[model samples]
Target: MKDPMDLDTPLKPPPAPGSDSPATAAPEARRDRTAPEAQRTDAPKRRSILGRVLAWLVVLALIGGGVWWFAFRPAPEMAARGGPGGFRPGMPTASPVVTATVEKGDMPIRLNGLGTVSSLATVTVRPQVGGQLTQVAFTEGQAVQKGDFLAEVDPRPFQLAVEQAEAQLLRDQALLKNARLDLERYRLLVKQDSIAKQQRDTQESLVQQYEGTVKADQVAVENAKLNLSYTRITAPVSGRAGLRLVDPGNYVTVGEAGGLVVITQVQPISVLFTLPEDNIPAIMARLRDGAHLPVTAYDRTRDRVLATGTLTTVDNQIDVTTGTVKLRAQFDNADQSLFPNQFVNVQLLVDTLAGVPMVPVAAVQRGAPGTYVYVVNGEDSTASVRPVTLGASDGAKTVITKGVQPGETVVIQGADRLREGAKVAATDGAAQPAAPTPSSEGPRPQRRPQRNAS
Candidate 1:
């Protein structure tokens, strides 16, 4: 009977709820009624949210721990990545090291300073006599020996004076001859009583006076010749001549204001420098003790030695303003490197210390006590800063009088980043025998270690 009204499609059968028969409705109502589905869906979703929150919390804790490790730990401990040997398990690795053998030797403490090149014995050459400059024998910049003729002043005036003196001498000689003949006749007449005694005496006196006048004329001739000879200008010392200040025609006044050219002696140049009064005792001790003080001059800008010489003079008094004493050193400047008034770094070696332990200046750290260095221990490779006594210093190297040994490697490269008892993995990883690589040249990229900014 129901099929008669229905189409070919199957018709859903209607159920009665009060008779305990199942019923189907909207999709949402069906889902709400399913117990297993509700519980299965809720359980997985809740577990997923809790897992996401826990994961985020764990990530934050790890980040916070890493930051603490970096900030609070020492450089060595950080370098190890929170473990020994600069390494941590399952972490990025560090470079391994092979050690170098360190040994003891006589370290010469080199004291470095900037200096200048100069020349000595600069002099002003002046014309001795004023005249027309007749000849110039040397060029403006030529080197001349002592007594080399430089120029000739006009000698015509001097020559004319000499001629006049010669002519006067001839006249004077004729007068003297006549007087002598008269004196002879007067003496003979006196013997025979042919003339009075007064007359003979007068003739003899006239002859003597004429002889004195002739002698005076001769001296005048010599004087004229001396002035003529003075007209030629000569070099007083072997030296290099500078530009002629006064040309040949210019008149030159003699004695005080007299100068023709400046002559600088180029060989065996002297360096005049000053040393502090505090250094005088050491300088004198070396000199008196028969230890020759080697004075070395250097060009500061170029950082090269200009000359080396023996110290010659030490001034008597200390300079009030600078608290220094004047000193002079002589050098064989065959190459003409040194000049007068040229400022130079004068290194005076008071004495040499034999077999003194030395270290790079960087290794010496100034602490509470005067000076100290970090001594790396053999057992744990830990370091403790120990106070030291020191002596003379070369700007690059320092003299260690006490405390540390020569063979021990005092950290030069990484010292600025270290502290007491901090474990240090030597980037070079060995005891260094002598001084460190000259970082005065600055850091080289290939061998440069990452500096500890702290």
Candidate 2:
């Protein structure tokens, strides 16, 4: 009755001899057994977590090393070789250049300016007397000489006026002759005591009056002749005729606004130009020395030479507004290359500097120091920077006052790519690249080819 439930439970194990009693040993053993089983079950899980953490740490370390290698790597060529004097070492490529020999010759000092082609004389052919324009004698744009017939007005009216003047003159001459005969008769009667002196004086006075009338008639005839001559308009100057202003059958007058045609003298033409006021003293000095300065006229592009001439005159005063003085140059424009009112470039050779060291203007270069040139050394095919003192320049050549010698070669073309003590491959002729000099930083980096994506 007391252990009907206890009979269903298992029996407890007996304790060892030296150990505590069975009741006490049973509880201790149970606790020890349960602790060991729990520890064994958790061991595998702790080891698995530790392994996972270590694997992640290894992956992170590999990624960091790869990033450093790719970003901080040096170029293959630079890493393979070292440079001298802290500059990268490589075979310097020789720059191709064109050279010119410094020469000892005359360099003309010239003053350049813009100019206008003008006629030595310009005339507007207009009718001197008013009448109907009856004829145009010259063709448009025709060359004409002075006094050449250009146009004609109607001459009928002028002819009639001339005839009337002639008739009047004849009438007055007849009257004068009759009066003179009567005066002669009266003088003879007075001398013979047949007529009074008063009567003779009256006849003499009548003759004088008639003579005066005849003289007046003569003046009228001359005037009428002059007017008739004016009916034929003539070119006042030798020149090329412009377009006709008044057509035939149009009534023209002396007071017309624009003349019949304009004529401009193109041959032996004059060029009107201006130079800075400061140049006046030099120009005047040369002029006083009896030097006939040479002037050259070029087309607008300044490439083609139109004519060569001599300086004719300088204006009296400098223009206050422009600070320039006007100059005139005369050219024998035989080819008619220069036209009236055309724009041109003028170069006046004021003086010549003889026995000066000169070089092509392209050889001169400006830098922080001043003017310089790249002089090619003959001993070694290399170029060196040479400082030079620049004097007068004639556009094509420049005078080098110092630091360069005659017969020495200087780089004219491809100087922009030069450095001090740079090797060069020079050509004898003028054909050379005009590219500018490379910068001083260094040679440009070589580009790398990209790989195709897989």
Candidate 3:
């Protein structure tokens, strides 16, 4: 509630004790003095805050750089040292490996196949005539020769048939004889005019009819004899007999499912095998030249040779489904090593390379480029990779057509650690000469012995 003019007016402090001045000072002077002091104090605070922010930025940059270096660094061993053919420092000097010298030898070209032993002749003996089985003459699993008695049926019935046929033949013969006698008498009667011509003709016809009957009876007798012989069954071939099928007292007939016994010729047996159809051309060429190729049969594991044989024949046609051809080989199984239906592995020697550079099959290794081998340097005992061309292999030795020569050493074992110029030592525990290094000088010369003064 004061006056408006009084509110607008400013107040001032009391004057100093010794001065006599006005009570109020200029307002502009007071504002100017305080503004300058406030600016000075705020300037120092701004500079200190900026310095702390820059220091924090520097620390964060240092931490990010260290994390990147640790995460992306390469392994020590795999990192390149100086250049190619140079290994890292502190690495082992040489790798120990087994080696073999390449040699010139004859290598056989062989074809391997799976086969089954079969008999040249297998017979199932059965009764030709139906009757009760009376006796078995041969034991099971017995070896018998041709015409050996195997079993017998009851021969009494066959014998009775033969006797009946013989009696009928005798009766017809007597009738024929009587008719001939009557014909002779009829001709004599007609010539003497004692009997009519018609009567003589009738008698002649009777004689002819009786002669035909006698001939028919003779054939019956022969047939009956043949049946009698069949009652005593004999082996049609020479072989080892199998288990008896029809025991004594069993009624066996000609139409029985399984025969009485089975006979298989094992002494001179055969094997049936199949080979890839691609090999047929080579095999046929050898056969055409009248060369008797040798075939060997081994057990299922191919560890032991069962028998040696000659290639007997080849099938005319190839199997379409499997792209193979069947071949038969005959063996003189003298030791009875081959048995019927036995599984075996077969090898056929088709051709032989007279002289070829060969090495152990283990020396060959496949890489990205192709097949290669590790060839050891003779002077320095260091290994270098050599790409090679391969030929036929017999599972143990391989024929090297190129990239290797006779008497050159090749690494066969412990080659996993080998590089292009790696040093290698023999694994056989033999003392090996020290590998030549880059700093090694040539062989030192020896001074001649000085002559003694006289």
Q: Write the per-residue lDDT of candidate 3 for residues 1-454, one digit (tens) a residue.
A: 7675796667677777875564334555677899999999999999999999999999999988888876664322343365688756754356778888888999888888878899999998878999999999999899999999988889999999999999999999999999999999999999999999999999999999999999999999999999999999999999899998888999998867899999999989999999999999999999999999999888765656789999999999999999999999999999999999998888899999988999887899999759999999979878889999999887667999999999899998877778778877766312455444432111111222347882
Per-residue lDDT over 159-276 for candidate 1, one digit per residue giving the tens place of the 0 to 100 score: 9999999999999999999999998998999999999999999988898999999999999999999888888888988888988766656655564264778888878778777656
Selected candidate, larger lDDT, 2 vs 3 = 3
Error of 3 at 73 (Å): 16
Candidate 2 per-residue C-alpha lDDT over 1-454 given as tens digits, one digit per residue, 9 for 90 to 100: 5685777778777775797985787999899989989999999999999999999999999999999987774322222134554654555656788998999998777788888898889887777899999899899899999988878889999899999999999999999999999988998998899989999999888999999999999999999999999998888888899998989999998867898998999989999998899989999999999999999887765656799999999999999998999999999999999999988888888898999999987899999758999999888788989999998875567899998999999998898777788888898644545545442211222222336782
Instruction: Report lDDT (Cα) of residue 62, candidate 1.
Output: 100
Question: What TM-score against the true fold does each predicted structure earn?
Answer: 0.64, 0.66, 0.68
List CA RMSD, all candidates: 13.6, 13.9, 16.4
Ranking by TM-score: 3, 2, 1
Off by over 4 Å in 1: 1-120, 170-211, 248-259, 406-409, 416-454
Q: Candidate 1 vs candidate 2: which has greater TM-score?
A: 2
| Model 2 / residue 129 / CA error / Å | 2.0
Model 1: residue 12 alpha-carbon error in angstroms = 85
Q: Pick the candidate with the highest TM-score.
A: 3
In order, the Cα lDDT scores of the candidates are: 0.71, 0.85, 0.86
**Candidate 2 structure lDDT:** 0.85
lDDT of 2 at 384: 89
Q: Which stretches of candidate 3 lie above 4 Å from their native place?
A: 1-97, 181-204, 379-382, 421-454
